[model samples]
Target: MDFEKLLVWQRAKALTVSVYKEMAACPDLVFKSQITRSALSIPSNIAEGMERFTARDKCRFLRIAKASCGELRTQLMIGSEIAYVAEPLAAVWIIETRELSKMLNGLINRISD
Candidate 1:
């Protein structure tokens, strides 16, 4: 299956793009770098996982993607608290991360079975 065809991958990709666009003007270089990295990791890992030959390898990458979702969510929460990110936008991104994590979990279970 192509990673691009997966809804989870598509959503993750969108989320990454949103993060990049919204944080483009952020002054906190360190925080922006960390947040963007976490956001980017989600779809990147999904793509890598889908390209893997074995279920174990695929699941490993999916797990990494899921963890990235958590990392991104945490960063967004911090960004909101610190005024780096707007509260409304941060809330939306946080929800997206949760949804992506759930999607990744479902995909992992399906691939494992």
Candidate 2:
């Protein structure tokens, strides 16, 4: 199966792009870098896991991706609360992250079974 064709991966790629754009002008370099990396991790982990030869390895990476989703959600919330991220954008991102997490859970279960 090709990871690129995955809906979750596609959404993750979009999320990563959105995050990069959102943080392009952020004065807090550290925050911007961290969030973007977390955003990037979603799709990267998905692809890496999909490419793996074993179910165990795939699940491991998927779990990592799911964890990264939690990290990203927290960062986005903090960014929104601090007014660093616009409310509307943050809202969409938060929704997307949650959805991605759900999708990842489903994928992980499907793979493990």
Best by TM-score: 1
Please provide, for model 1 over 2-111, each residue's C-alpha lDDT reduced to its tens digit, 9 standing for 90 to 100: 99999999999999999999999999999999999999999999999999999999999999999999999999999999999999999999999999999999999999
- Kindly list the per-residue Cα lDDT of model 2 for residues 1-113, writing each as its tens digit: 89999999999999999899979999999999999999999999999999999999999999999999999999999999999999899999999999999999999999999
Question: Which residue pairs collide in model 1, if any?
Answer: none
The residue ranges of model 1 lying beyond 4 angstroms of the native Cα positions read: none
TM-score of predicted structure 1: 0.99
For every candidate, C-alpha RMSD to the true structure in Å? 0.4, 0.6
Q: Could you tell me every candidate's TM-score relative to the true structure? A: 0.99, 0.98
Tell me the whole-model lDDT of each prediction, alpha carbons only.
0.97, 0.96
lDDT of 1: 0.97
- Model 2 poorest 10 in a row by lDDT: 14-23
